[model samples]
Target: MTENSEANSPGWFDKPANINRLIVALVSACLVLLAVEAIFGKSFYDDHHPAHFPIEQMFGYQALIGFLAFVVVVFLGTILRTVIRRSEDYYDR
Candidate 1:
């Protein structure tokens, strides 16, 4: 290797990689979003929170509602999944 070649050459990794900048940008974006939510009082946690009852008092209601929601979701998923299962190897003679 000549002096001109070494002088003109990019040492190992001289070019900037995009991934580090992208990861930093994503982390900054999430922090900004959290900061905005903290300032504006808007949060998914607050939105999905259950009713205004104490921990001990609402256990039964929470359990009942949760069980109902679970049943409904499971029923819906079962119906949807059965639609795909109905076409099992029917075309093979």
Candidate 2:
């Protein structure tokens, strides 16, 4: 295709996003999750001490753990790639 044809081609806005539907879906998911937690979070919010941590803390810890795990995985990948890297024609005669 020519440059003019490519330039006229559709981008993301060619199909507009449903802002209202997205907002409604997001709100509904949050409400459902909150209801589920309220029903099953009794034990976590029962003990009048460290055991009585808020659900928010659990979410925070989960996020922190995921980020740390991702960082470790990425670091290991970089190290391995560097250690095993070779020229593009290393195997060619």
Per-model TM values vs. the true structure: 0.29, 0.38
Q: Against the hidden true structure, what lDDT does model 1 obtain?
A: 0.55
Clashing pairs in 1: none
Q: Give the alpha carbon lDDT tens digit for every residue of 1-93 in model 1.
A: 122232344543344563455557666865686566456442323646633645424324444676689999999999999777655666773
lDDT string for model 2 (3-91, tens) is 12323445622443644544566668667866666667646444555543454456435446666899999999999999999999989
Model 2 poorest 10 in a row by lDDT: 1-10
- Cα deviation at 91, candidate 2, in Å, is 1.3
| Candidate 2, superposed: residue stretches over 4 Å from native | 1-10, 13-61
* Candidate 2 residue-pair clash tally: 0
* Clashes by residue pair, model 2: none
